[model samples]
Target: MIISRISRFISNFDNLLALFAGACAVLAVLFVLFLPLPYSEDQLYPKEIDESSPLYPYERGGTPFERADIHVQYPENSPFAGYVTAYLTPFSLALSRLTPHAGTTIVAHPGGILDEILYNTRGLDTVVETTILFIAFAIGSYLFRKGS
Candidate 1:
């Protein structure tokens, strides 16, 4: 809805869509890799389940075994972990079942140094260049519009 205001400020819906798409693509990659969610702190620096920790079920504060559920504060010990473990456990069973049926063939091919660098970097340089180009295109498209 806010972007609708830009229609009057600029011109051409196609340019707006291009700008929106470019911005969204940049944000998607950044959030997936670099941006940390609020639970990231808890996930990274999980407190030990000791007397000093809030997760400790002590007689002084928290009841002992009164809560039969695994708390989300300890993500590693949560039901989600159990679910993921159960899901992946089938893969190992399937692999074991299929191992004897398949022929064993292992091949290792070394890639070039340039290819390795591009693979490891994931073309961040390309992303940066594309982002600059997108910004420039949006600005030019708006400024060079027929009316304004």
Candidate 2:
């Protein structure tokens, strides 16, 4: 039937699918490695965080994720800064599911290469994004092999 023909036609493109998926995965990782996520101070830390109080997950150096700095803040001077940030770090558009700050907006800063490298070093965002992309690659490979 037509459905069977369509299925076979799709299966024949498995290799192409795999290649495209792999390339996308690599690009996603690169973006994460070279993008600085924009976050507010409250989003980066707990609302009641006390750096000098020595409280767990609240004090300075207590959180596992990186802190928000001026670089990560949305530029007030530019009206299109938010749009640019969201566009550059599209992966962060996902709903905030990480710990410490659940109700926070996550976007990437349009920073230089060095800024990207330094900002991503201490956060779990890059790791999470990379993992998701890796999973996508694995699934694509599996499908490709299954069709072969």
Candidate 3:
């Protein structure tokens, strides 16, 4: 009788683990599907400059077009800036999808603040996805073990 009880206990444990694993797999798939793609209008494309255009000289700062210069300025405290920073990681990952040099730059000069944001955001997303998948798998493993 003692031996039978021990066997039953072991079986129960196995069922729990299986349920957890299944749950994790399901959640991982769902997250991958629902996760949003990151992007920004300003950073989406390279700024265009025409040699004959008056704004051409001001592309890198020294120009009569003050607003154009200011547009590229990084405002770390701004809400938009925060969003940009938060999504930097995702953006970088997205970039990598297109090319090999996605997250290669440690501190993208002049774009440091934005780059930091992107890196941090990507890190956060990875963590969250990992956690969700882990939990889902745990639950699925548990259920499977019990059913077995």
Q: Local distance difference test, per candidate?
A: 0.41, 0.44, 0.47
Measured by lDDT, the strongest candidate is 3
| Tens-digit lDDT track of model 3 for 62-112 | 211111222333344432433332232445435535654323351242233
Cα TM-score of candidate 2: 0.24
- Across residues 74-146, which tens digit of lDDT does each residue of candidate 2 receive? 3454333222212323333233333334222332233222233334433467778788999999999999999
Candidate 1's error at 32, in angstroms? 45
Error of 2 at 140 (Å): 1.1
Which tens-of-lDDT digit does each residue in 40-111 have in candidate 1?
A: 453521323334422122112222222222223345533332222112123433443555322111001122
Window of ten residues with lowest summed lDDT in model 2: 54-63
RMSD to the true structure for each prediction, in A, is 19.5, 17.2, 14.6
Lowest-sum lDDT 10-residue window in model 3: 61-70
Supply candidate 2's per-residue lDDT for 135: 100
Whichever of 1 and 2 has more lDDT, that candidate is 2
